[model samples]
Target: MVKQIRAFNQLKELALSQEILEDSRTKGVVTALYEALKSRDAEAIQKILAPDLEWWFHGPPSHQFLMRLLTGEQESDFRFVPHSISAFGPTVLAEGFDQSRSIAWVHAWTVTDGIITQVREYFNTSSP
Candidate 1:
């Protein structure tokens, strides 16, 4: 019975350590992504994103259009500021507000192997 308890404790410790490691890696990827976006550095963004990354936008077509502008796919002067950040499992979420446009947005990112593999973004669909 004592041996079984010892083995179970070891397994629990290993699982906890793995969770911590995953959380750290997720934070690193999301931090790099946020910095790249804030600077509008396409090269930096590309470094942290997987080559086959797909980003989904939840809103009207107008929101998708705005995302293109924000990501530099289309020419625009708007820049987003991330005000809050949180993580769950393999996903990191950022809440941002653009005071000039009076808009708030949420971006959810799925990070794997230290790279952002998927992104889901929601524009100002909720009242502040």
Candidate 2:
């Protein structure tokens, strides 16, 4: 019985450790993407994102700022500053609000193998 319990505990610990490692890695990839955006480094952004990236957006069409940024059509005055970032498995959720514009935004980023494969953008909406 003691040996069985010890083995179970070891397995639990290993699972938890793997989860933490994945979370950290997910956060790192998302952070690097944001840093690239902030710097307007198109080359870096391209490297971080998959060539066949998938994107989705909700809210007003005019609120597609991230799309514009990715496409090199972003306005000079607009910026996305994520105030909160959380990672769950391979997905990262980044939320932020622009006080000046009263715009609340959430980005759900799906990363695989250190490359961002998809993004779902929400504007003026509560985080899910």
Candidate 3:
């Protein structure tokens, strides 16, 4: 019985280690995307994002800053600096507040095989 318990504990630790590795990979992909954005490298952003990327937004039309930024329609003065980032499986969550615009934003990004496939954007709102 002691041997069995030890084996179970070992398996649990392995599972947790795998989860941490996955989380790190997911976060790495999202962080790279943000780096690409910060550099305004459209080609790099395109490489990170899937060609058929899916996007959903909840906020005023004017607040669709990410999309505009991606499309080169956003004003140069605005910036999105995520204060918190967390990952669960294939989904990554990033939250930030922009004092200049008084906008609080959250982004739920789904990454697959190191490519960003989907994004749900919320601006000026609280996320549960």
Candidate 4:
């Protein structure tokens, strides 16, 4: 029916709009997180993360597993450049490297429920 067609079109438009908004939000979160790394500020990182969260690096970290990756000797070297981002349900995947001049994998994040519930970092003698 014509009414059904109109409703379908409206729904499609709304879904597209939501996708755009979500993409923008994802970009914002990525930028904010990177800034936190550069600053090495724990408080700033906590601002965007939920209180109950955990990190799981693909490989083991050179150092011990930690809660917030702020305040350290080589903290300045912590950086990541995400290659691609995808969202599935409540999860967001950001696969990149904590790289600078080198392409070694530093850290990665898999955020969920609008907060970073899990972190997959591999900061060591490993390749991304």
What does candidate 2 score on TM?
Answer: 0.94
For model 1, the superposed segments whose C-alpha errors exceed 4 Å read: 69-71, 126-128
| TM-score per model over all chains | 0.81, 0.94, 0.91, 0.65
lDDT of 3 by residue, 1-128 (tens): 99999999999999999999999999999988888888888898999999999999998887887988888775665677899999998999999998866789999999999999999999874322
lDDT by residue (1-128, candidate 2, tens digit) is 99999999999999999999999999999999989889999899999999999999998887888888788775656788899999999999999998887889999999999999999998974322
Displacement of the residue 58 alpha carbon in candidate 2, Å? 0.3
Which residue ranges in model 3 land beyond 4 Å of their true spot? 74-76, 125-128
Best by TM-score: 2
Q: Identify the superior model by lDDT, candidate 1 or candidate 3.
A: 3
Query: Which sections of candidate 2 miss by over 4 Å?
Result: 125-128
- RMSD (Cα, Å) for all candidates, in order, is 2.6, 2.8, 2.9, 4.0
Q: What are the lDDT figures for the candidates, one per model?
A: 0.79, 0.90, 0.89, 0.58
Clashing pairs in 1: none
lDDT ranking from best to worst? 2, 3, 1, 4
* C-alpha-based local distance difference test score of model 1: 0.79
Native-to-model Cα distance after best TM-score fit, residue 17 in candidate 3, in Å = 0.4
lDDT of 1 by residue, 6-110 (tens): 999999999998988787779778988777877778888878889888888887665564468545577766666678777776998988887766777888999
| Model 4 spans > 4 angstroms off | 63-68, 71-76, 81-89, 95-101, 106-108, 122-128
